[model samples]
Target: MRLVNTFAAAALATGLASAAFAQDPTKVGFIYVGPVGDFGWTYEHDQGRLAVIEEFGDAVETTFVESVPEGADAERVLRQMAQSGHDLIFTTSFGYMNQTMNVAKQFPDVKFEHATGYQRADNVSTYSARFYEGRHVIGLIAGGMTESNIVGYIGSFPIPEVIRGINSAYLAAKSVNPDVQFKVVWSNTWFDPALEADAAKTLIEQGADVLMQHTDSTAPMTIAEEEGIIAFGQASDQSSFGPNAQMTAIMDDWAPYYVSRVQAVMDGTWESTDTWGGIDSGMVAFADFSDKIPADLAEQAKAAADAIAAGELHPFTGPINKQDGSPWLAEGETADDGTLLGMNFYVEGIEGVIPN
Candidate 1:
């Protein structure tokens, strides 16, 4: 009877210990579109992941799979993360939108955040930074510094995000230098070094003295440096890759957002939300201008960036027209958020079809 009582008591103690140890650390997962060492888009996002690690040392555990392709592979990766007991997962690419949505339905308990996408669900959220604001500042610098009156732009896709950057850059450049023209080449990729380098060479051959890119690799920057032309960094600082060619960079700061979202999940306050943060919110920032840029031009760019952050100026405010000369924004009328989110056509003076 004593042995039986002791066994029951031990079993009760074991149950209590099991209950105590059942609270595991919150698990977070990240899916990257490119390698973390790309030193551009994926690099910036990996920094955010590191920030999450720093913020919550023992309370949270983070895992990442880099260079995960964006179709069926992405869906498989997301499902695997969910099955592994991940409390939160971030799909950091536009192509992962539908996949993210599909996975969210299966793992309704897991929180998912998709970057640069509009889709959302009860367990899914959307987030993006206003990179176009930074593009405008660089455009001004590119216009003032170009010697051949031509600025070459490298694009990843013809999506609204990339299109918005192109248009914003062109408008800012035109405002600064009336004779400046933009030569845009779509690489149809986010991170292909050979293709981006080839595009840069093609543009340089066609008389582009300044280079800009919406792609993620540093190939364009390297080409610009080798050719003695100035260029702007895409998602992160590429000055090391192009000491003299890098005039400035549009930095994506996702650390604060990532930490906050993770904390939200921990606090039981996480809800599906769409967050589009910009310069005003510190989501989009800039690297220091290169010494190659004239001091006056650098000052103007800084002042313009300040004006943008302070709401004193709007990049899309204007009398504008579509590619076919259709009236779009009237004089002094700023673009609405909805129109900008769905932007697909080039401005009146851009001189090209959107490549449906």
Candidate 2:
């Protein structure tokens, strides 16, 4: 029964693609998890949306709805977009995974793309970035610069993606300074500035001298600046929020990928494929190092960044152990795709759960 449904879905997607090809001015739509003015995740995605419009000018038309919550409202908005004749839809949030899948089944004639998710169907594709790569670099700086040796991490969820970043950052920090320790606070919501600011204040009260956040807002950075501690930006270049407190930032560049996918649709070659890019691919990038960072530590971070981009170093190499003291990887070995994709445990140096 499952196989039959899969075949039918594939046939439907193919038919839709054929019809879209036979028409001019392909219609594309986007769904954002936050407001376009958030200056974080959604804002970066909207930049990519603009790039798509500029690239395909007369050949493509695009529309988007911002600040859509991730449950029934998301499904309703997606269905409405499809009903409005959007040939392709891009759902820009991990929480939209199952919602996208459900909507795709209902709108078999439309192609769907989800960001930072693993699930895929005949009409759905998943894409993400090696964001932890940037975290590793920032961790090194945090470890080297912290007089308190306490770093605070503001995370949104305990999922594999967020946990993998926490572990990678911890490993990098421990490698530089054995005394460095991490404090984590999970807020569960992605874009709540008030809640995120309160979490940052709590971490500051706990003696954290360097701050990092996985949540999608500038609140954490602003808090770091107000408290005179160092912080790193996420999803977008947020240094403007904390010029003195921001040591560096990870910027998400999605224009290239967006262009390629749209071109695939134009050329009749669109298919379900998972894309994960790192430093070398320009999908994941770091902002310029700030003068607040120690000159020597900045040099070290840049060297590591160069090595990773040149394919000479990997952030997740072993002999590594989990928090339970069980070996996770052997010496001279690096984590494979499957292991990284399913990562749900903290390394020995970390002191928290991977959160269910």
Candidate 3:
């Protein structure tokens, strides 16, 4: 009798599985590191999520959890989504690398996409934008406009992504003005508005006339506006936050990539791959130059943008040096994908260490 009952239970489970397969709505989920209302990195990614919903309509179902921490909570959230029958999941933060990997291992049948991570499994893929390209253009404008020759940088962490942006901005600034120096403050958190604002004020006190940031808030720009200094936006278009102070913005448009990934899943063609797109691919873009930027400088920035799009210029060209006065690249040489992938040191003109 017990064996018969066990067989009956197995049959019922199979029947439920078949019913769910028939009724499945192509579920996709996202996990965010910051509030969607931050109007920066998380906001841009959420915009992509919304685009997926609109593009797929009734054919797909989507949900997300915001303000997820990087460790155990992230693992729990991702596991819950997988157990709930989500077909695909996107973890949109650098810190989610290992958690995503672990979860992907557990749910081998489900697909996982992580941002800014190097690790990969058969079920896991990674994607990110070349944001520093946009930073180079705005750095030129900042260097041209600054009267003090000192630029303030608010950095979230010393990871390669943020470090790359800092070094790129410094290199571009020094290219236009040899006297320019960067003052950097490391907050160690991605979206702490209070810390970001404090860092901006401290840099201003240190005589920095221009501000740039790798953080995900409008607070630094707001402070710059109040103090009558100039700043650039990061991860999103933030001109509305500081019309007078914001010179230009680096905007991240993830909608196209999101739609393509979802369609691939629907077609059963999803595969693990790394995607790094810049201006030409429409993943990374620059907002219009603010009126605070001189007309000639804006023209120069636009020309650089066009050149990048046309493949006429490379940002990490040779004749570059490390902060320790060692040659990183020889003259007439450009950086290759391998070097940029593992960049961990500061370039010339940056003052601080790339914190661990």
Candidate 4:
């Protein structure tokens, strides 16, 4: 049910993909917050792990622990990986940030990569895709297609990443359909199917005809399919779960980065850095557009996505305002990375307070 775009495979064909095999297999470890079968965020990440194997073959031995809870459990798993001689470790969850750092301090030799976190250290790197870019495109489609103008957004958290997505998607929807309103319900957890399904039904009851989710499950998509409403897939393609409902999906192509980072460790050229790649870099790829989408609207969505890839369109361009209606960005000015990375407040027009 998951199709990694050809773009992702092409990106995975890195400089090291064809490199000569080294003597010892590089010991790479992965920590996941959800099961690989979730068919969403964790599924895509595990796919990246598989890509590392496909590209390097026996030159690298990759191991992963799935459904590992974030916090003491994550730290314990990480310490065990480090102690077991894992040269490189990827902690693939936002909640694993502090734990990754703490464990990195203990194992100075292990290279650590933390996803969707801002903090970095001498041996730790922070990397995340511009997921909001795809959100904006889907928002455009959702805006043009929704008959009720109510788009239900299931948010996993109120952090900058989630808040930024909510704003970007809303802004794009509002731009296309002025009456389009986002009804956001935070499930708070990243991969709870029951909770996600309940949130989707609640949104439908509140008059949402289109469902969008940031959580990592197909439950919402299943609900949308049964409700005969359209929705977008998260993290990976969930088209199988809702063939008619999924308009398109945003795929987080992590294979390329994983390969290159592992190659770095092998070559002893690894250095701590922060990487934020978007559509242009293939880090943010998309699934096939549904035939149900109008050709004209599909063209518009592609054009907008192309603009984002070309860096010509920033999703958060101003004349935007704070939720309080205070001016945040001047006309024609775009938001910088710092403000976007630390984004805390909701934009104007979104209702309800962000959960603490």
Candidate 5:
């Protein structure tokens, strides 16, 4: 009987240790520049956070602060999360770059991942999707479908990332239809619905038949639907908001990246790495083409997407010119990552001042 009691006590101790281990969950935090319900960038990022939750059921705990401003307030929120013992934090906005860097300096132990930022630190990693690839595909569709030969693009900021997308879209459109004209309007805000809607209306009023946006709001799509024009969804699929108006969406799939990063942290292999994934890496995806697009043009768009994913074609191939008509690339040459990463000016044929 004494021997049996000893075995029971030993088993109880082992169980207790296992229970303690199970109680310690990895705490992860996410900071959003816009509300999760914006149905654009933040919503898609929240979907990735949800993917993390689903990937590691009880092994991880997650929290988020949404609609946080991208200034000092971002730093404060990040500091709070770090102080709260968040093991990993993802800041999902370009404007949060300095704030993320500042917070990372304060907490060297916490890991940070900032989206669309060039800055990096020992504890902070930067990541972004090659959204330009998707832009190229949609541009082909726009070029083929536009009756007015005018395409309007709503820009969020004059940053390189947004500029790259505009240039890519315009280049692709011009390739297919040299007569295509681009009109660009800057909204300056990423998530203001009223401002985005006003921009859309203004562009349409200015004789734009096709509308595209780099901003993170469905207001443009909503306006497109009301005005019976074609538009593309940005960051996330906004088809539900504009079934007829939405030509296709450029989806940012953060699930795979987020899950892998979190797994690295759990396995003690997390490091400061810059990841720029695109259509080939499954980071940039295209939603289904709307029926408004002709079948032949849709096929061409899909083929172009396939070519990009397979690396058989590059969007920034030579014979391209800068905004001032200067030779940017020679024939049979391609633009390297260095130049693409800091693309500040428009390619030839795009007329506008990149607001400082």
Candidate 6:
């Protein structure tokens, strides 16, 4: 009797699996690290999610958990989505890397995508934009507009991604205005508005006339407005938050990429691969310059952006050096993807060490 019951249970499970496989719509899920209302990282990613919905309509079912914490809660949420029969899941934060991998292991049939992460599995894929390209543009503007010659940068963490942005910004700024300097402060958390605001005020106090950030909050731009200083936006357009202070914004347009990925899944062509898109690919976009910048400067910034998009320039073009005054890149040379992906050192002339 026990053997007969075991066989019946196995048959029922197989039937259920077959029924699910015959379903028409694909189920996709997203996990976010910050509130969608933040109007920054999460908001841009949410735009992509909405695009997926608009593109697929009834052919796909989508769900998202916003403000999901990075560690244990992330793992739990991902596991639940996999168990709930989600065909694909996008974990949209670097901190969710391990959690995504762990959940992917437990559900071999489900596909997982991670943003700004390096790890991958047979079932996992990673993607990120070359935001350093936009950073370079903003740095050029900052270098041209700053009266104090001191530009401020508020970083979200000490990771390679943040470090690369800082280095790119500094290099661009220095190239344009040799006297320009950078003051960097790490908030250590991605979405802490209070910390971001505080960093902005501190940098301003330290004589920074222009502000930039890798954080996912509008607080820095808001502070820049109140202080009558200039600033740039990150991840999304933030001109509404600081109309007078915001010069330009570095936008991460995930809509195209999201639509493509979902289409691939629907067409049964989806595979785990690493995708690093940039200005040329339309992943990195820049907002229009504010009126605070001179017309010539704005035009120059636009020309630089166009050159970058046209592959006429690279942000890390050498005659560059490490922070310790050692030679890094020779003239007319550019950095490779491998070194840039794992960059951990500051470029020459940038002050301070990268916190671990």
lDDT of 3 at 244: 85
**All candidates: CA RMSD (Å):** 7.5, 6.2, 6.1, 6.4, 7.8, 6.1
Greater lDDT among 5 and 6 belongs to 5
Candidate 1, clashing residue pairs?
A: none
Worst 10 residues of 3 by lDDT: 1-10
In model 6, what is the error at residue 282, expressed in angstroms? 1.1
How many Å off is the CA of 346 in candidate 6? 0.4
Backbone clashes in model 2: 0
**Residue ranges of candidate 4 with Cα displaced over 4 Å:** 1-22
The digit string of per-residue lDDT tens for model 1 on 39-87 reads 9999999899999999998687778888988899999988977876789
| Model 5 clashes, total count | 0
**Position 266, candidate 5: lDDT:** 95
Note the Cα lDDT for every prediction shown. 0.89, 0.88, 0.87, 0.91, 0.91, 0.89
lDDT of 2 by residue, 1-356 (tens): 00111332343456764465555567788899888888899999989999999999968878788888889988988897787667888999999988999999999889999999999999999999898888889889989988899999999988888988998899999999999999999999999999999999999999999999999999999999999999998888888999899888999999999988989888889999999999999998998889978789899999998898998989998999989999988997999978888788899987776667
Each candidate structure's TM-score, on Cα atoms with residue i matched to residue i, is: 0.94, 0.92, 0.93, 0.93, 0.94, 0.93
lDDT of 4 by residue, 1-356 (tens): 12122232232345343344446578788899998899999988989999999988878777788888887988888897787667899999999999999999998989999999999999999999999899999999999999999999999988999999999999999998999989999998998899999999999999999999999999999999999999999999999999999999999999999989998999999999999999999999999999999999999999999999999999999999999999999999999999989999999988888998
Q: Estimate the TM-score for candidate 2.
A: 0.92
Candidate 3 per-residue lDDT over residues 1-356, each given as its tens digit: 00111332343346764465565557788899999889899999999999999999867778788889899999998897787777999999999999999989999999999998889899999999988788888888888888999999999888888888888888888888999989889988998999899999999999999999999999999999999999988888787888888888899999999999999999999999999889999999877778767889899888988888888878888899988999999998988876787789999767777767
Clashes of each: 0, 0, 0, 0, 0, 0
Model 6 lDDT at residue 84: 70
